[model samples]
Target: MLVEFTALHWIYVVFIVLIIGFMVKRWDTSLISILGIFVLAIVATGDLTAALSKVFNSFIYAITELLSTILIISLIVAMSQVMKKSGINEVMVAPFTKLIRTPTLAYWVTGILMMIISWFFWPSPAVALLGAVLLPVAIRAGLPALGVAMAMNLFGHGIALSGDFIIQGAPKLTADAAGIPVADVVSASVPLVIVMGVVTTITAFIFLRRDMKKGTLELVGTYDGEKVEEKSENLLTLGQKKFFALLIVVAFLLDVLAMSLLKLTGGDATALVGGTAVFILLLLAVVAHKKKGLEKTTSYFIEGFQFGFKVFGPVIPIAAFFYLGDSGFIKIIGEYLPSTSQGIVNDLGLGLAALVPLTKEIAVVTLAGVGAITGLDGSGFSGITLAGSIANLFGTAIGEGTATLTALGQIAAIWVGGGTLVPWALIPAAAICNVSPFELARRNLVPVVVGLVVTTIVAMFLI
Candidate 1:
């Protein structure tokens, strides 16, 4: 497939590089991201007034995409605030403290559990369900809060989401695009996913341990590191605390059962969890506070919203810029591209695939590279069709390894954009752990890159 390259495409490519460079340097990319949106709008619409409007419209679009995640995180936090005040959170995590006695056990146990839950419920709800309960336990076990975030992120968002074995969403998308059965892609992906997961997770653990030993791990703004004032009065008695704790657990377990029985996934699954959190928050607040229940519910919500927005504020501009790379351009700047355009991101991916040589080795490297490139937009699913199409083309030319190539591309795309290396995409874990998303992204960079490299080499052999 021949894809037309336009000025709009070039402008987007340049800004993507600039944004990534800024992030690598730990510099705020909000200004550059906003500028990128304005420039893209001005060039596309050729109307200064329309361009100005797009700047604001882009932010709205970004927020809309992120609102579900924001709501779930806030609700979980609100429920947690009451749990903490009532001593329910402590009670809930007490059992885990026995199992997670050391930092090593905490990291692996939390990560493994997150990966399992994410495979079923997906990472957004998994983060919410586990973070509140396990974060405190992990921290108390001597792991830094950021370490816990990385563990959840790498396992839940990176490993489980990339493979998507149970949900099969990722494999289905790529397989359909490749004109193959989903099972073929899933079968080929198992080895690749295992290789990538084990290598990346082990590398991360080694680095985390090294940093801990050197006393160089950062703890800024984390739950363990921050100094939060505690309420002097215990709102709930031991019986009440234990009751609410058990109720919380049973409610989430029912959510799991409902998800399995009703075949709920993604947003529906997240909504179920968020709604349950709200109910728990209200019940705990009213029962604990008595006459002040109404006031306290609102207060807890306010606190939760404050935390949510603060964590998400820096992310909005960056997400806005990237959204334009996919579907947001038409919405924010009007339908200004040529009719042949497959949005800027897909067009770029196709153009890159067209340029690469079709040798087996080059095919392996190009698939991984193209997968990572498509992931730059931060919606891991958005550009995967391009990866699948490219895999089909390369597989035909090489006369083999179509399934393996497609699987490799899917894994690379999701690991990079699904929430491991991308700052905004991984914000749920960061926000829940009270760590900086950029720092989490930075910490993930080396391990993920190494894993991709090794996985790419393994793909070369498989091909």
Candidate 2:
């Protein structure tokens, strides 16, 4: 169907273009998003008072939609902090360092473990979790600090965040935007993530070897030709260490078993992670610090909430704007305006269906570009709604799989803004590895660019 546009549709189009322009200029979008909602609401409601109410309602809607994700991330971080303090984290990974005595082994093993942990606990927590324990080991193994950083960066942020299979945060955002089920996007993301992950890590490994051969493997971080020890402050006994480690493994294993038997997925699975983290925090606190456990537990809550809200702050306004382009339109404006012809961005996107002669290749590449552009603000997720909305538009236009296209945009956004390309976003991994964020971004450019290209091409076939 050829879509017809109204004055409201035109306004939304203009707003979208302006939003992209602001992002391209590397400006924060909170003001622009709020302004967009203000103007869109005023025009839609035809009442200044009613329009003003929408701005607040929109943010509340966005927050409500995202609270579960924010909670899970915070809880996981708090759980990780306790694990680190209890020395369980060090014990958990100690066995791996014994097998990582060579540069190549150090690179592959660290990268693999980082990916696995990042998938479960997220890169924010996993960086400290993996880096503190494994970083010195990889460096002591004659692997350059730069090499270790690249391995951690690509596997954790690039591969794990891009797919987000365990957390489902990235997929859920895009899937919601595309008007599809989260499970479908997760299902479609596996192959694309694997393709991107394999190609990018392998390509990065080749460059690491090439640099090593050229004697460029010198430490960029703190390593200076001396043996290093694990960075730990906890003094737990060996038996205590093993016990906590075992406790953690069993807890998560039970969660896994529950998921399979209960058919838990998406938000349900995420709730399990969050709830388990909270329980772990309490148990570990009591076990590790005894009388000080109460104080430490409260402190963990403070740290986790601070970090969670900080990340959530930048996203709320941005997501509020796009949520209006999805189901949020009705929720935010329904009291005053009963319905919309279609969601604002959706209308704009679908209206262009016939205007642009889109082949599968063009559609995939364009959506990927949109996804990358949205990531310029450096939060992989805040921009996902746009990617999902555009995928839905393109899918409607071309008679293809909406989930596949949505997954493609999701991977692109997360890989870039999630930490691979953006210097500011790469700080966690870079700081832990003691390398410049700029250099890490520079190292990642080639492999990530190639991987995105390969993945986008593969998406053409799938779509």
Candidate 3:
């Protein structure tokens, strides 16, 4: 059966296809393609006023919904900067270096550290910390900087950010679109995340082993100035080390307490992290620049915001176009698209469901593949809106048992696009390690591809 395409549907398909082409070719900025979609939507509706309204309203609505989360991310970044300036970040990772004596151990250690920190603070801040501290250690331990980057990308961006069990941002986004509780999405994501994590990590290890065998392994700092030499004397004063250690321990405990007492999840959890970061920043800044006072504190915050925007800004417009596909966002776009009971992505998915033979196994693979492909645009969470809509539509068309299939698709899409497979997503990590983003992406290719394959298989049997 051929799916019937409405004018609106045709517009969206063209927009999505063109965007995908732009990404594959690296022709122009994604922002240009996104703007083109906005123009196309307006032209389709044939209303200048409506298009103008959508331009302003849609951006406002999208920003407002995400404002708190964004602010929190900025704050946490700022705190990381403070920690770096204070030498606390180095102190934090120094102990771990002793355990990561070899290249292979470096990969696993970096992955584990990324996963733990990302679960609490989100991957963005986690990347900064890892890059600044653990990266040098891994490099010194005979791990390639590119390899260190891949490990961080897979564990932090792919595994931790994808499941978002602690912060709940990813699941919350999917659940909101699915019309289900955030807790339900979180519960469903746990097993899928574990499976993906194990597969991706093991695949990465295999590659690391081959590199080791070839004697191609180089210390991470060979290309950069990040090598850590073992000093006979501790560089930091004993009092300073003790104070920072207590500070780190207290901060971690506060995060746990906040998560437990406030029951914060998703955006709220991000806020908690960000708030704690600010508190830490203030505490550290005051100690470091007591004479400079509030002016220095202000500068630290500005620096943090700069980092946050640098990391997240490029994806905003891309997110805006996808937001147009949702019903909640259609009104923001104004009368350009008529209000229908169905979301654009949902309508399209339902149409496909009618034609496709969505058995249990087929459903899982199909959804996961579609999710991963949609994420090719490089904004991982942006695809969840599409995945959720598709899941709901196709789940109904196939069987009630397909909810997990939908969730699986959501997970795969974000995990891959969010930063794992995309060069753009790994920019901070690459920049910090002074490695090439494209090469880092190449390093991640096999592991992420194998992981996705394994994840789909696991989802089929488990879900």
Candidate 4:
């Protein structure tokens, strides 16, 4: 099957190389994306006004594909905000404090608990809880704040965020890019996520142990018997906290049950989760504030939107560029497109297939590298739409589940920019421990790199 190389195909390759180049230099991708759209549009249509319209339309199309995910994460973030204020979030992790009498226990326990809480609250709210309550305890246990940061980084950002089982925000982005169902991405990523999580967390723990043994980690020295206590003034009562936590657990259980019984996967399942978070949020608000719950909940919604849109803004332009190269282009600029009516990336992938004999191993590794490269911008979610797009491109070249490739890219993008490898994203956790974000990222480098490699290998076989 011989395919003729065209100017559009060459343009696609040049833009891709440029995108990766900009990423390597850690430049903001929004500008590159918009520039790519203009150049590609001009090459394809040669009309200035039409090319510019296509750029905005590409952004509109990408936002349409991403709106649901953005809303869900926002809703979950709002729920977490209320949960934290009400004290429901605290009750879930307070029980674990009794088990953290030793540094080793403190390190592993904090990571495990952070993973659990972040699974539900989506990390932002959980960071506050962990920092205020857990960090002091970990420090008291003689684990250097840096060690604590490493555990939280690997488990919360690397593992839980990579999997994103509860919220499904990450999977939705990858799936949208790959043009696959979110459930498929989630299902395919299970093995890879677990392997990545286990390998990275374990490897990090080994390093921490060595550092502790060598007394390389500065110890706070003495274990303080003084306890850090949460103020009960604004917090929910113990009964209210217990009841709300139980309520959330049962609601999630019902969601899982409904998913299994009704065979609701992907969007449907995600809707269920988002709707459940709203329900719980409303219930807790009313229980805590009665009629004023509505007013207070409104503020939470505002906060959630702020967080969601701030993150969403960076990714929109990036996603728009990738969308131009995928199925979304049809919606963006239909009549203006050439008669071929094929995606730019899919076309380039075909060209690659003709030009190079890339094996599955080589293709998977390349996709993984592309994913990591995208992560260099340090906002994990924004870069993944590109990963999803690239996964589709590679999936065409190599016969594998688009979900597998997409998930691999998602994991790689996240593990890097998600917080572990990115200095800025780690600020929340690092600030909590009063350690340097650069050091947090540095400590995370080896383990996360190993995890990415191992995860990519496993992803290759998931076909």
- Per-residue lDDT tens digits for candidate 2, residues 357-455, read 778888899888988888888888778888888888888777777899999999999888889898889888878887778888999999999999999
lDDT (CA) per prediction: 0.80, 0.84, 0.70, 0.80
Better of 3 and 4 by lDDT: 4
Stretches of candidate 1 above 4 Å error? 100-197, 200-233, 358-463
Off by over 4 Å in 2: 1-4, 220-235, 335-340
Best by TM-score: 2
Cα deviation of 77, candidate 4, in Å: 0.8
Screening candidate 1 with a backbone cut-off below 3 angstroms (N, C-alpha, C), the clashing residue pairs are none
Instruction: Summarize candidate 1's per-residue lDDT along 1-463 as a digit string, tens digits.
Output: 6677789989987986776566445466679889999999999888899899999999998788667756765776677667767877567656666799899999999999889767645676567667877877788888998999999999998899888865565776677567677778988999999999999999999999999999987543443433323432588888887888788878888887997899775567668888888888899889999999999999999988886676567657866777676666787788888899876766765666566645789989988987887676566665565577668767766768999999999999889878998887877888878888888999999999999999999999998
Compared with the true structure, the alpha-carbon lDDT of candidate 4 equals 0.80
The model with the greater lDDT, 1 or 4, is 4
Q: Total clashing residue pairs per candidate?
A: 0, 0, 2, 0
Q: What is candidate 3's lDDT per residue for 197-260, written digit by digit as tens?
A: 8988888878877986797755452344343322222334657756875776688778878788
Off by over 4 Å in 3: 1-6, 27-46, 139-146, 176-180, 220-238, 333-340, 349-351, 354-357, 378-384, 399-407, 434-436
True lDDT of residue 140, candidate 1 = 80
